[model samples]
Target: MALQHGVTHLVLSAFGCGAYRNPPQHVAQLFKQVLMQEYDGKFSQVIFAIYNDANAMRRGDGGNVEPFEKEFGIKASVFKEQ
Candidate 1:
């Protein structure tokens, strides 16, 4: 595990939300629960990187923005190149 190896920061992808057929919102909520409640402060930072393609854009929402904001009480930021 990353924690066992003394990893401070973690870049987490959307687990089971794609080919595994798991619900995106549910998976986001579960990740928040485990990271915040179960493994509180274990990592210096936890980043969720969601990639959006044409198909995902067609679906309107392809990332965990709302779920993550609701769970963490903060908004996720998007970095754009100028």
Candidate 2:
């Protein structure tokens, strides 16, 4: 849907959601998978603003930001500023 419309950027603004409320970590992966499948190769760039949600960011111990680049094959950058 979004991809079909040529959405270059996708934000998982799952704000005020259940999974975002609690998780064992995999929950976040599911979300990412869904997004990727929906917009795979459709967008030139995809950014995931998981905020401090370790699970959403796939952080095993703390948080791993590298997976975004390795798995998705897309350049992942974490931005924090005004």
Candidate 3:
């Protein structure tokens, strides 16, 4: 309902790529398809919030964040302060 309510940005995730063992590639593709086909240009920005945990990424070749980065063509980097 974000669209109906005039939402501009979105933060998505790799749904089902966790303990459910859903393939990240497939999940990422579906997310891309729906957003591009249905919601393209509807929002100012779309962000995929994939926690870059090494253990969580161990399931697939690139892990949870990799597929999303590839699918969306952007690398999500966490900021750290020294």
Q: Per-residue lDDT for 2-82 in model 1, tens only?
A: 989999999987665554545567777788778878789889888887644333344456544455566667777766445
lDDT of candidates 1 onward, in order = 0.67, 0.52, 0.80
Report the CA-based lDDT of candidate 1 relative to the real structure.
0.67
Query: Pairs clashing in candidate 2?
Result: none
Over the full model, what C-alpha lDDT does candidate 3 score relative to the true structure?
Answer: 0.80
> Regarding lDDT, does 2 or 3 come out ahead?
3
lDDT tens digits, residue span 1-82, model 3: 9999988999888887876778888899999999999988999998887654555567648778778888889877855435
Q: Which of candidates 1 and 2 is the stronger one according to TM-score? A: 1
Candidate 3 matches the true fold with a TM-score of 0.82
Instruction: Identify the leading candidate in terms of lDDT.
Output: 3
Each candidate's number of clashing pairs is 0, 0, 0
Off by over 4 Å in 3: 52-55, 79-82
Please write out the lDDT profile of model 2 over residues 1-82, one tens digit for every residue.
Answer: 7756877776653342233444424444665687667646776755556454535445344344444345456565668656
Which 10-residue window in model 3 sums to the lowest lDDT? Answer: 51-60
Global CA lDDT of candidate 2, please? 0.52
Clashing pairs in 3: none
Q: What TM-score would each prediction reach against the true structure?
A: 0.70, 0.45, 0.82
